[model samples]
Target: MSLPDFSGTTPQERLASLRRSVAGRIVFTTSFGLEDQAITHMIREGGHDIEIVTLDTGRLYSETHAVWAETEQRYGLRIRSFHPDPQALAALLDDWGANGFYHTKDARLACCGVRKVEPLKRALAGAEAWVTGLRADQSQARGDVMAIEFDTGRGLAKAAPLHDWSREDVARFCETNGVPVNALHAQGYPSIGCEPCTRAVKPGEPERAGRWWWEQDDAKECGLHVDADGKFVRAKEAVQ
Candidate 1:
């Protein structure tokens, strides 16, 4: 599926063009963070025909849920929710016990696979394109992200409209547009993921330092962004 060349176009224009170009569905996955809120505002207020979706890990913070609700109300759009497969989740728990992710990197990736990655795969099925709120400054792993690329893992074109935006850029857009954002950002959480695996990063730390802070070397990805090299592959192919 060849995507439209978005060179020299604004993010809004690019998104609109992408929507028009794709014959199949174009989906955007949001975590309800500041960046996602900014993109959500563009999709909603700009009247782009795109499906907004999110993964419910069943372990998200209450504040995240509040922001999700606020976003829906603000934009008057429904953000589709996907969940982990019940049998997969149950089998993971039975094998590793609850909270087994704390023991090893493989265990942690396994938990994230059940909670985030698998759900995202299901959410993106049949979609010609998937949009995300990824920014270059978020982490070294994402530093080289492009505005558009073919996602080999999911066999779809991936777009990151905020690829060149900085944290301040996202915040400013949200502030100026009155976009609903998660309140955790004000309390030092630069990035917000599932409740247990995320924390507040100290000053001077990387934006994603709060996520899986215990893991010193593993990339801070939840399998949603695995590229050709398969940097953070899931632990088990079959859930059970």
Candidate 2:
């Protein structure tokens, strides 16, 4: 696939350029974080055809839901939500109690897989490109983010337009564009995920220090960005 032009005078221009250049359908998954909110603004203002969706892990914070409602109200755009299959959710609950994930890393990953990864697969179905708000500074596990890459396992092009932008840059963009964002970020939760698996980090902590924080430092990520072949974008050397 030919690489789309990811450069522009502004983030909105870059995203609009992507929409024009990329072939087939494009899906943008937002977690209602600052970075995602910035991208949502670009998509809405530019009136791009990208489908905006989110994975409802069912354990998200109430503030997250509030922001989601606000965004839809502001944009008049219905952000599609992908939920875990009821049967699959039930089976997971039956096997592991609601909070079982806290006890072991395996359990946590299992929960993430059932709640996030599966739903994400459904969300990406029939999509030619998958766009995310991933930034290089979010965490060491994601520190090597690229603007474009071929997700071989999913047979789709993945683009992270804001990969080079810092967290402060995203926040400034949101403020300048009036994009709705989750309120949890102000409470020291720079990287917000499921309520059960997330917390507010202490001073000087990395953005993602709160996500799955109990596990070993290297044991980051919830399998959402992990490929089916056990390879991760951050861990592998850049292909291009």
The candidate scoring highest on lDDT is 2
For every candidate, C-alpha RMSD to the true structure in Å: 5.3, 2.1
Residue lDDT tens for model 1, 122-204: 99999998888888778887777777877767877888888888899889988998888799999999999999899998989
Model 1 lDDT vs. the true structure? 0.83
What is the lDDT of every predicted structure here? Answer: 0.83, 0.84
TM-score of 1: 0.93
Once model 1 is optimally superposed onto the true structure by TM-score, how far is the C-alpha of residue 235 displaced, in angstroms? 24
- Write one digit per residue (lDDT tens) for candidate 2, span 35-96: 88888888888889999999999999999999999999999989999999999999888988
TM-score of each: 0.93, 0.93
